[model samples]
Target: MSTEPDDIVARITEIVAAELGVPAEGLAPETDLRGIEGADSVRLLRVVAKVEQVWDVELDDADVFGVSSVADLSAVVASALQVKA
Candidate 1:
């Protein structure tokens, strides 16, 4: 997979941190998104929506639902960016 830009990763991390109410530093690429303390389907989708706003990209629902970890979501965002580019 293509590596995402650092700025994109930072923005995504910020969105996740904000939506999930966790410190950005606590969100590693490998962190289990569903395992996070307050994460649920609705909250997760909200995070995805924030990412879409930040990156100006819409991700496939299939891809979003398939993501199990932050790395997976990052990859999906990176792919969406690539498509937009």
Candidate 2:
């Protein structure tokens, strides 16, 4: 299954929001994941894990930790999917 960049961002926003216990509607593509009120290392990692699960791709540790905003993560996921393809 192929996921478009916008779809990746939306799904990731949902995952991050769920993990951080915030409303998904409150998140924007430019929103920094680390800046979220309840965001912590473990919670952010969970979001990464969920993204990996949903997309069935393994993101590099460097890429995962390097991402700050939802858009950044979406770009990384798009790159990973490209590599997989």
Candidate 3:
């Protein structure tokens, strides 16, 4: 897959870190989001909401739910940004 914009990835990582109570530095592209400590559907959705707010873009539920890791989420965000642009 192609790389996403650095700014988009950075902001997405920041939102995930803030909402999930995980340090941004601890998250990696292959990190399993659902496997993260204290992570649940609710918390994950909160992260998604925060991302939407931060980027002023909406994400599809299918795409959000289908994402299993940080990199997948970043890809979804990048696609959304491309559509918006």
Q: What is the lDDT of every predicted structure here?
A: 0.83, 0.91, 0.82
Clash count list over all predictions: 0, 0, 0
Best by TM-score: 2
Model 3 lDDT per residue over 1-85, tens place? 2235766667667777888898999987778989988899999999888878777789999999999987788889888878988
lDDT of 3 at 31: 85
Cα-based RMSD of the predictions, in order?
Answer: 3.0, 1.0, 3.4
Pairs with steric clashes in candidate 2: none
Clashes of 3: 0
Better of 1 and 2 by lDDT: 2
Q: What TM-score does each of the candidates earn?
A: 0.87, 0.95, 0.86
Q: What is the lDDT of residue 12 in candidate 3?
A: 67
Q: Weakest 10 consecutive residues, lDDT, candidate 1?
A: 1-10
Candidate 3 regions exceeding 4 Å error are 1-4
Q: Give per-residue CA lDDT, model 1, range 1-85, as digits (tens).
A: 2345666666677788889899999888778889998999899999988888777789999999999887788889888878888
Report the Cα lDDT for candidate 2.
0.91
Model 1: residue 63 alpha-carbon error in angstroms: 0.4
